[model samples]
Target: METTFKNKVALVTGGASGIGRATALAFAKKGAKVAVVDWMENDEMVNLIKELGSEAIFIKCDVSKIDDVKAMVAQIIAAFGRLDYAFNNAGIEGASAATQDCSEENWDKTIGVNLKGVWLCMKYEIPEILKQGKGAIVNCASVAGMIGFAGLPAYVASKHGIVGLTKTTALECATQGIRVNVVCPGVIQTPMIDRLTGKTKEGIERFKGFEPIGRFGLPEEIANAVVWMCSDEASFVTGHVMAVDGGFTAQ
Candidate 1:
């Protein structure tokens, strides 16, 4: 068809790698001007964007900081004229520890990046989208958001809070032409998981057990779902927590 998202302007946080990176590329491929935001520098990804012959620009950002998020959004509108879509995908895979053992620092960092970061991004993103009179937003949640998981208290709590925020925000903007949604990914094949499991065969299989599909998800797989949610194809969809967990939540 007409290449969905053509001429759109999209901003993706955590865009240097994983699902964020894939979503940025996907949007660019569909003819959207992409703004890639992440704190880390990934030259290979930066070069790849240039190689794709698509309009993509990288901005180093730490979403946990509200001021940074505000400045980033301002820069996006200044450069792109208006923001049509945003993937508030910046988050941290926090320290895995039982609720009793989780330290204050770890808890603060986890909530700051995972929950507050999403809030900060939305805080600034919504106003701009409202100005445009239409926009789509997708926040990255986890299967853990839907249920409890031992030894991951902070991460679980943060993700769960994101789901709640997504629903509330969606309703508040439903009549204003803004659609907000959350994507709950299962064990995705990303560096964050690699760090958690050492990237070994046994490590990979261990995480796969959480999903009924018996495999970890690919970043591109998650990106594909995000693209659909943010496009007109899902016009009737809003405030949904779509689980990209390979049936993890189905069981």
Candidate 2:
């Protein structure tokens, strides 16, 4: 066997850490040329990609900046000749505060990175994919996108917007060779979550127990879902938000 992504090229935003990093490595292992884009630079990830003996580039980018996003995609096209897949996984966990207590800056930051970033990425990336005559895009939304979370108003709103965009984009590209979908992950054990939820052992355990699975998700688990959505294995799947939340939304 050949991997579904063999010979393909993929761009993963937030690829320096956590889920995005895991996904990039997964794609590279499957023989896809991977572009790892993130605001933070990680030498370990870069070294790991190099160790795989696959073509991988680490691009420092603030996904919320339109110019940065454009430049990043341009670099990918220059490197790979065409973009076959994109994981719009760059986003922030906004301040956990009530709507009334949330600052305007919080709102702007969350929407800029989570919503506008995704929009700008697709706006620039779609053309490249169209040029290629076939491509796939998987946006990272959240369970918060599907339901309201009281303390995280900004994050909730941005995620919901992501889901809406995912649906409409998929519909627009249904007749085209491009496929678009969203993945909604819930309570994953990521550095962001660790920082936002608290670092104390007990606090971490409490947070993990919130998920029905009795444990938070691993980055590789979410990466698996993303790779599948980007692969031809999901050729017929589009406009759907597949939840990988350990049944967090089932209830």
- For each candidate, give its TM-score against the true structure: 0.96, 0.96
The candidate that achieves the highest lDDT relative to the unseen native structure:
2
How close to the true structure is residue 76 of candidate 2, measured as C-alpha lDDT? 90
Write candidate 2's Cα lDDT for 39-76 as tens digits. Answer: 98876776787788788888889989989999999999
- RMSD for each of the candidates: 1.3, 1.3
Q: Worst ten-residue run, lDDT, model 2?
A: 1-10
Displacement of residue 220 (Cα, Å) in model 2 is: 0.2
How well is each residue in 63-125 modelled by candidate 1, as lDDT tens digits?
Answer: 898788889998898888889899989888788888999999999999999999999999998
TM-score of 2: 0.96
Query: Against the hidden true structure, what lDDT does model 2 obtain?
Result: 0.90
Please give the clash total of every predicted structure, in order.
0, 0
The Cα error of candidate 1 at residue 95, in Å, is: 1.2
